[model samples]
Target: MHPQIFGVLLLALAPAQVFCIFNRRTWGARTASSPLARFDGPASLVVIHTTNTNPCSIPSMCKSVVRDLQIKNIASNSSDIAYNFLIGCCSGVYEGTGWDYKAPISHNYKDPAIHVALIGKFDESAVPTHMSQSLRALISESQLRNKLKNSFTITEHKSNSSTRKLMVKNFLQGFAEYKEQVNDLLLPEQRAATSTTAKPAVSVPSSKPSSPTTFSTASDRKATFATSTSKPTTAKNQFFYT
Candidate 1:
């Protein structure tokens, strides 16, 4: 093999490295309390969530928030933390379960999805734009690293049946705009599922064939009529013609 050709091939085949945006140590993730296992590449969906009671926007407050959650997760008899990532309004992003990790956090049934959560109560307070964008960037980079299809899903914890308690209040409104940025990354099946359930297309019927109007004069306007005892036919209305 030619040296130039070999060098070119190596460059083309090498996997691109992904960098973390948030400072893990800054957010006080000293170490994993328990052993952490890595998951296989390219998660199908990225689930957004927040703490149940705390909506702390300040970075200082987030240290305790992460600490407390870790302790609680361990107390619950679960290994390490439940989420793959955590975002604070001021803290950027903190490593939770870490990338390529299958968080014990369940979505739909016991299915594990890539999970990212804001540290504060987004339901009451708005999610900072920086926090939102950082989350998007992180997911986008991860998708590239894992060689995932362009299509992926953005969801909320409340969307998960088992983790309703981890709901990030009022986050959907902002999430709408965030989803658009990564819309192209969504898989074909995801788009097909959306189209299948979309509102039925509206159909307008052509005007009915016109009927000529004619009137007959009554007998000197004194014609008497006997009431007929007949049942009227009930026909369902059709709006369009095939």
Candidate 2:
């Protein structure tokens, strides 16, 4: 092969090789207390979720949040963190149960779906561009690795009957915004359906809103955590969308 042609090919492929993914070790994730089941085949669906907590952007803080979540999951009797991958607000992607494992949040052991949780409460705000880009990159990486199907469909996690009434509207609002933001990343059929379908109208409660919470970016050193004084909202709150 000609040296010049080889150099040109490498330059063309460089961007595709630049994705950053933080592995379990990077975040000091714990071993699952219980045995984890492996996925039988590549996932065909990607379920989006929000942590419903404060967003973390800095690498150190994001790692701490992920570690805490893992510990919380284990304490709740879950084998490991429920989601397959988590996209940090600014810190990039953090691996959860990973590609080959069947996350406990899935409908069943045989369910062909990859669950991805975005760090932070997105119910009332748009997902930050950095986080969305990381998510897109992660999805592309999953497809390249054969862990996710090229034609995978994306959907937001919906709560069950008990919480659905209180949470669905909030989640749908975020999902609508998210869907629009990532439209270009979707498959042709998915994009067509989204464009044709009208987004549902969400009614905002007349009650006084809670005080606004601030999020830290990659440059910020201090972080503010959301307080429990605020009313509970949707996503990854005990229900896993199948």
Candidate 3:
């Protein structure tokens, strides 16, 4: 390689190396159940899904759910990755972001729209036993964490599973209501305030505060569904568990 190009490459690597050194000062892992998933708000809705639909391929039933339930804020970059939090039907917490209460473009996301995935097609079918119950628990806790003193809304792609999990307000931790949200994507306690927090600490360029997650492919989505419909046959089953 050319010496000049290699020198520039060395400079590029320096920041990433430094970031690895300092990341322990940032996000802490606080379990998948933190209310810091969305920022403070009188959240309008929590989006719920019943499948991992790769709409571009074999028409997925969840495609309609994504279309109807996903919020089309101009700032979210793409229509994909639209949910504030996605809980797979297998009770796994997959992708999530945002809890912003301020400017949609500049601030972090804090949407109360807790989206859950059925891990398979649910528009015309049934969700797995574990998924159906796990999402109820999460959403129920979310109601209390967000301090929804009054009635709040929980949304799903379909009108089935009429969630009684809202009863979670009666089952919340003693102090979840008192805790304030930090930035909105994660708990303040979970943020890299000190060591010992177990966040998935990935290194990236300094230009971005958070790194981008890779998108699921059509084949991957199909495989996710296939695994859900039958016994585990793919690697995604690991992700679907709590």
lDDT of each: 0.46, 0.54, 0.29
Lowest summed lDDT across 10 adjacent residues in model 1 is found at 2-11
List clashing residue pairs in candidate 1.
39-100, 55-120, 55-121, 123-169, 150-185, 151-185, 151-186, 151-187, 152-186
Residue range 109-150, candidate 1, lDDT tens digits: 233357777776544345655565456445544554562323
Residue 53, model 3: lDDT of: 49
Model 2: CA > 4 A from native: 1-17, 108-110, 159-242
lDDT of 2: 0.54
Q: What's the lDDT for candidate 1?
A: 0.46
Please identify which of the two predictions, 2 or 3, would achieve the higher TM-score against the true structure. 2
TM-score of each: 0.54, 0.60, 0.33
Across 71-162, the per-residue lDDT of candidate 3 in tens digits comes to 33222443233444443433333323423322222122234434434444443334444443334333333443452222434433322233
Instruction: Flag regions of model 3 displaced more than 4 Å.
Output: 1-38, 51-80, 98-112, 147-150, 158-242
List ranges where model 1 is wrong by over 4 Å: 1-35, 107-112, 159-242
What is the per-residue lDDT of model 2 for residues 51-148, given as tens digits with 9 covering 90 to 100? 66678867677889899999888899898888888877663567788777877887532238788887876555666654544555565455555677
What are the per-model C-alpha RMSD values against the true structure?
26.8, 15.6, 17.9
